[model samples]
Target: MNKKTDLRVLRTNQSIRKAFYELIQEKGYEAITIQDIADRAMINRNTFYLHYQDKPDLLDRCVEELLEEIKNAIVQCPISMRPFSISTLETVMQTILEHISHNTSYYQAMLVGENKIYLFQSKMEKIIKDKLNEGWTSSQGKSTLKISKELLLEYLVSAFMGVIIWWIKNDLPLPVEEVSSQFSKIVAYGHFKAAGIAVEE
Candidate 1:
């Protein structure tokens, strides 16, 4: 049946992805080949070709899948719980943190010796920007923020990405909830207060 075939294909793809991750960790991405992946995945080169055009295609799909998962998590977060509230932000942050934590090894591997940081940062910025645009548009002109939407998106994305990279590099010393809470506070209340910076009225 078509359903059974789909299931089998799914399993094959998962196996290939898992193998690719393991190989990347062990041998690095530049050193990996399709044959190597197929050997590790217990599939033939022809089977690998059937599923993916090449190793780069596989990597692209892997990153795309991660982005899709993150986007879905953000989209599914319940806005009605408390729209634009720190609690809601914390929930969203927690979802993101949990995803990163769950795939720590993969992230670590991807982030090293490459410009992959931009890949993640840009994708996250787009997702957050889209979400914020939705919120702003739905606010019925009641939202009053002095900053441009583009700048706000860049600032948020950069800040979050910096923290995430630092956390990952340090092996995530703090718990996800604690980090999320701290990040939410920093976003809700500017860091100038914590740093004792006086603002000119």
Candidate 2:
């Protein structure tokens, strides 16, 4: 009976989440209401309130959960093995791409359309920035950087998000490996493309 109860709760949560994502994709966040979610999830308003304080709370929790997964994926990138290596960056990007592939709807709802949540983007960038900075602190050779660490990292994160959004909007036109590899190349060899400057590997 306890197991059945737990399974029911889990199922309800999944239903609510699925309904929320579908609604966000269909009508945008601002227009959604408690009744809308409950209707879509086939649950009562009281049930919705039992799980979340309100729509904002639901959005917060959903974003938090998804971002936590992204943080975990970043942690799995083996930054310690080669903190600033192109391969490490590629691995991290590919990991993120693969993870997003598993939850495309959530990302699409939060990031891809006119009604997308900018707050999600802002929060995600901060997480990525924090992780990259953490990696930089643990690694060496930062003394050789010609630009401020903050500026360089900000640039990298912006470009990183740009590539991701582009991929998501395009319905993932390129394979994850190829996109990650090209991204790394752009990061490591962008100056080469802009000018004749050769970047040492």
Best by TM-score: 2
**Residues forming the 10-long window of minimal summed lDDT in candidate 1:** 111-120
Shift in Å, residue 34, candidate 2? 0.5
Model 2 per-residue lDDT tens digits across residues 124-152: 99987877777677776645677787898
State the lDDT of candidate 1 residue by residue for 1-201, as single tens digits. Answer: 999999999999989988887787678777889988999899999999999999888888888888888888788775421246877668877888899899887677665435243565567667766765565565655546676776876686677777777787789999999998888788878878644678888
User: Candidate 1: lDDT of 64?
Assistant: 86
lDDT of model number 1: 0.76
RMSD of each: 3.8, 3.4
TM-score of each: 0.76, 0.89
lDDT at residue 159 of model 1 (Cα atoms): 73
Whole-model lDDT per candidate: 0.76, 0.87
Model 2 error, position 144 (Å): 1.8
